[model samples]
Target: MPVRPLSPELAEKARNELNETDENKMVDSLQHLKDWLAKQPYLKARTDDQWLAAFLRGCKFSLERTKQKIDLFYTLKKTAPELTPLKYKDPKFSEILDLGVSIVLPKTSNPAEPRILLMRPGLYDPNKYSLGDVMSVGAVIQNIMLMDDDNFVVAGGISIIDLQGCTMAHFAQMNPMLMKKMTVAFQEAAPVRMKGVHYLNTPPGFETIFNFIKGFLNEKNKKRLYVHNTDFESLYKYLPKEVLPTEYGGNAGTAREFTENTKKKILEYSAWLDEEHLYGTEESKRPGKPKTAEELFGVEGSFRQLQKVIMIRELSPDLAHIAKTELNEDPKQTPEDIKHLREWIMKQTHLKARTDHQWLVAMLRGCKFSLERVKEKLDLYYTLRTTSPEVTLRLKPTQPTFINFLRLGTCIILPKATTGLHPRVILIRAGRYDPEKNSVADIMCILYYMVQILVMEDDSATVIGTKIVVDYEGTTLNHLVQANVTLLRKIVAVSQDSLPLRLKGSHHLNVPSGIETIFKLVSAFISEKAKQRLKIHKSADELFEHIPKDVMPPEYGGNGATVAENIEYWITKIREYKSWMEVEERLGTDESRRLGSLPSDEAGDKGSFRQLNID
Candidate 1:
C-alpha cells in the first residue's frame, strides 16, 4: 500500500522545516544513506525506501547525522532488548496492544497536520503491566508508522498523554533507570520527529518526571509542549474537535474505533515485525569503538541498573527534598560529592569500581555523603573478598546449591518497595531451609548477595535504610547447631560496618526456644549501635505495631502478594543481577597492592556453633 498523502502545502513545510533538498538531491541522499548502511560492518538494517525515507525525514535528511542515528536505532534494539524483546505476541505484550493505551487518530482533511498519538498511561494496571511494557508497545506502533503512515513521516507527530486515570501506583512501577535512556531513545534514537507533547489531567507526583523530560526537549518541543491539567478547552486551541476522537469531543470515531484500526495496521505487519529482530548492530563488528552502558547511562550494574539515578527516581520529589534537608546539603551539590569520590576511587590502585553518577549517588546517600565513611565503606566492600572469600568471591548464581537454596523460598524481598522514608522490606525465613543441607555460611552467602543487589539497585534502601524482618517461627535446635559463629560474625561485620545502608531496623519475630541465650549470642557479633535498633517481638501483634501488615506478605494477612509469589520475584531479581555478580567476582581488593593494612571489624567471639545478631 502507498503511504498516506501529505498536502502540497504541508509537503513544502516538511521540506523547509526538515532541511529537505530538491527532488534530485532527495533521491541521491536516499541512495547515499542506503549505500552507507550497506558499507557499515556493524549494522544490518532495513534499507527499503519507506524505512530509509522515514529516517531521512526524522533526521532532516542529513546523511552523516542519519548514519549516526541509524547506528543508535539498531544498536538500541540489540543492546536494550528488555525494552523491545522478541515477544511479538506474548499474552502480556498482546494485552498492551489490545488495551489501546497508545493510539494514532486518523488524519483529518488537512493532510499537512501532524499525526496525533494519544498516549493514555493510566489505561494499564500497574500490577499487571509495567511502564516498559507500555513503552515497548508504543515503540512497535511507531515502527509501524514508518512503513505505512506517510503523513507521520512527512508532516511529523504529536503526543497527547492523557493522564486522567493515572495514579501514584502506576508511577511507582516505572523504572528510574529509564529516565536518561528513554529520553535518548525518543529524542535521539527513534526515527520520528516529536513536534508536540501535551499532558492532560496532570497529577501531583508527575511534576518532577515532567521536569526531567522537559530538560531533554529541544527548543521546538519545548515551545510546543502542552500540559493541560483536566482542561480540555485549552487543548482545543491547538488540536481542534474535528480531529479528536469522540471521547475527546471530536467529530472522529470513538477511541475504540481508532484503537481497533491502529491495532489492525500493526497486526498486518506481524511478519515484518518478526524480521525486525534480525536488524541490529553487532558492536564487535563496529568500526572504531563499541558503546557500553558506561558510555550510555553512566553506570552499569549486573542487569544494567542505573543505581545513581535510581535514588532520585525511587523517592518522590517531596521526600527527596526532605532527605536532602536532613543531610544539611543542597540537592544540587550532590554531583560535586560524587565527583570527588570518583576521583578518590580512581586513585586507589587496589580497586576497580564503577564511577557512574547513579552508582556514586547511592554510595554517597548511604554514607550521607561523608567522604570519610564513603571511603571506608567502599574499601571494606571490595576488601570483602580478601577478608572473607568464602562468602564474597564464590557466589555463583548458576550453582545448584544457590538455586536450590533460592528455591527453598527462604529469602524474600517484599514488593512493597521502600518509597520516600518507607523502608524496602526484606523478609527472611530463618528456618525455611534445612540446616543439615546448608551451613549458616552458605545461607548467609545467599543473603549477602540478596542484600548486595538490594543496596546496589535500591537507592531508597541505601538512603533511608532497609527494614529487615527475620521470621524464626519454624526454627529448631538443629538449625542453631549448624549455624557457624565465625562466619555469621563476618556477615554481621560486613553488613553493619562495610555496607553503606543505614541498616535501618531489624525485627525478630517468634524468637526460638531460648530467647536470652539467643539474644546474648547475637549481641556478641553486632555493635552496640545496632542493638538499640533491634526489635524482638514475642507475637505477630507486637510485630504489627512497628511493621504494618500492609507492607507484609499475604500469608501474614497483609494486602500484598503471597510468600510464594515474593520468593519467585526475589529469585528472579537476584538472577537479574547475575551479570553484576559475575563482574563482582573479577573485581575486589588486592591486599598486596595496598599501602598499609586496612583495618578490619572483628568484635565477635570465636566459639562453638551459635546464633549471631544480623543487623
Candidate 2:
C-alpha cells in the first residue's frame, strides 16, 4: 500500500506521545542570533550560529564559575550557605551544581542539567557585521576564566607539578617537575595514564600562576612536554607560556612555550574544525607518525621508484622468459642490482619466493625489465600459459556435419583410380606434409569428393574414380587411405537402403560402389568363409547364374551374400526389362500374344538375349 499524507489526528497523536515542544528551539534561537550578527557591520566577525552558541556557552560557563561543582551538592549547600543558585554565578565560587534530568542530547548526555549564568555585552551597535570579521567569544571566555582563581597543573620533564603557589618549598613539596616527567613517561610506557593536581583551600590569581607557568615552561632544564589538556575554569591559573610553548625555544616543553604554541595550534585547529568538521575519536585527534619516505621528502614525496618498477613490469612480457634468459647468460648478477631486486621481491610478499628459482621467475614476471637487463636495470615479471586436460572434457556446441559440410557443386573422376590408392591418398601426396593444416584440408577434400561421387554417379564410375586416385597417390599414403576406406564403407552402407528402380530390361542398382570396395577390402583383410561368397557375387552376371540355388546351401557358402547378390542382380534386370514388357503390353495384339504364347524355353532364350545393363 502506498503511504498517505499524515492526518491532523495522527500528527497530534505523535506530538502528544513524543511530548514534543520546542524541539529545535535552541537551534532556531542560534540561527536568529547568527542572522542578526551577519547583518551587523563592525561587530560581525567570522562566525556562524554554531560559533555563537559555543561562545555563549563559554561565556556563561567560564565567566561566572558556573561549571564548578561539589561531589556532595547537598552537604556543600548546607555547609556553605552562599552556595545557593544565586551564588553559583559568583566569580569566587568554584563549585557548580548539576540538576538531575534525563533527555538525550547529541555529543553529550543531559542527565546533569548544568546551567550557566550569562549577560549580554553592553558595548554596542548591532548593525556592523562584515565578512571575515571574527568574534573571539571563546578567546574572551578563556580570558575571563584565566582571571578567576582555579587549581592548575603544569607538566614538564617527568612530572606534573602543582602551580597553586610560588615558593621553592611548595614546589619541592608538590614536586611539579617530577610529576610532569612521570605523566609523560607513564603515557609513553603504558597504554593510558592520567594525573591531577587539586587546589581546594586557597585559589591563586590567574596572572601570578600564569606568569610562573610561563617561566617554568621557558626553563631549559625541563624535558619535552608532548601532550596536555586544560579546562577553561583553570585557564586563569596557567601562565601565558603554558598556552603556547613554541614561543620560548621553538619547542613546547616549557609552560610558556606550551601555552603559546597550543593557543596557535588550537586556534588553527578550531578554524579548520569549523570549516571541515570531521569529528572522530580522541585517537584520531593525534596525527600519525610520518612515513619514512614521506619524512625524508618533507613535501609530497616522490613514489617514482615504486611507480617505475610497476610500469616496467606491466609493460614487460612474462617474467619467466626474462628469467630463463638471464639464468642462461649470467646466473650471478651484481650485488647492488640483486639487492635492489631482492628488496623489490621482498616487498612483493604475496609472491611465493621461498626458492631462488621461484623468486627469479616471480621478478621476471612481475617487472617489465628484461632478464638481460637485470644487472643494469633489474628486470622482473615473466608469465607462462597453462594447459589442462579439463579443456578436452568440456562439452562445446558444434554444427552438425551435414550442415557444415561444404559441397564443391562439381564432381571430377579420380585422377588415377585404375591403380590402388584412394583419392584422399592422392591429395595427401600432392599437398604439403603439415599435420596441423595440410592434413585437415586433405581429409575434408577427400571426404567431400567421396560424398559427391557416391551420391551423384553410378557404382562403376565411383569405383573407378576412387581406385584411380588411390593408385596415383601410391602406397606412400598413411591415415588418409584408412579414412578414405572408412568413408567409402559408410557410403556403401547408406546406399543399401535406397530404393531400386527398374528401367527397360535393367534395374537401377542402389548399391554404392564404395560398399563393393568395402566388402572386397574387408574380405581381403579378414580372409573368412564370407570372403569367398563376396567374391563370387562381385558382378550381377556371376550372381544371376546362381539365382536358382538354395540361398542357405553350402554351395552358396551358406551365407546371405549369394541370395542378397542374386536378388540385387534380378532387381536390376527387371528394371531394364520394364520397357520391353510395357511395349509388349501396350501393343497387346501381336507382340503381347506372341510373348504370351512362347514356350518356357523360348521365353528364357528371349530374356537372356535382351541387352545387359552393366554399370
Residue 194 lDDT in model 1?
75
Score every model by TM-score: 0.57, 0.14
Q: Model 2 over residues 3-119: C-alpha lDDT tens digits?
A: 122245433432343222233633554555556544433221323333333333322222112111111111222222221223212322111111100010111012121111111
Which candidate wins on lDDT? 1
Look at candidate 1 and tell me the lDDT of residue 300: 53
User: Best by TM-score, which number?
Assistant: 1
lDDT at 223, model 1? 88
The list of candidate 1 runs beyond 4 A from truth reads 1-149, 158-192, 195-215, 219-315, 417-421, 602-615
For all candidates, the clash counts are 5, 86
lDDT of model 2, residue 439: 30
The segments of candidate 2 whose C-alpha lies over 4 angstroms from its true place after superposition are 1-23, 56-161, 164-615
Q: Write the per-residue lDDT of candidate 1 for residues 3-34, one digit (tens) a residue.
A: 23446876687667887656666679878987
Worst 10 residues of 1 by lDDT: 606-615
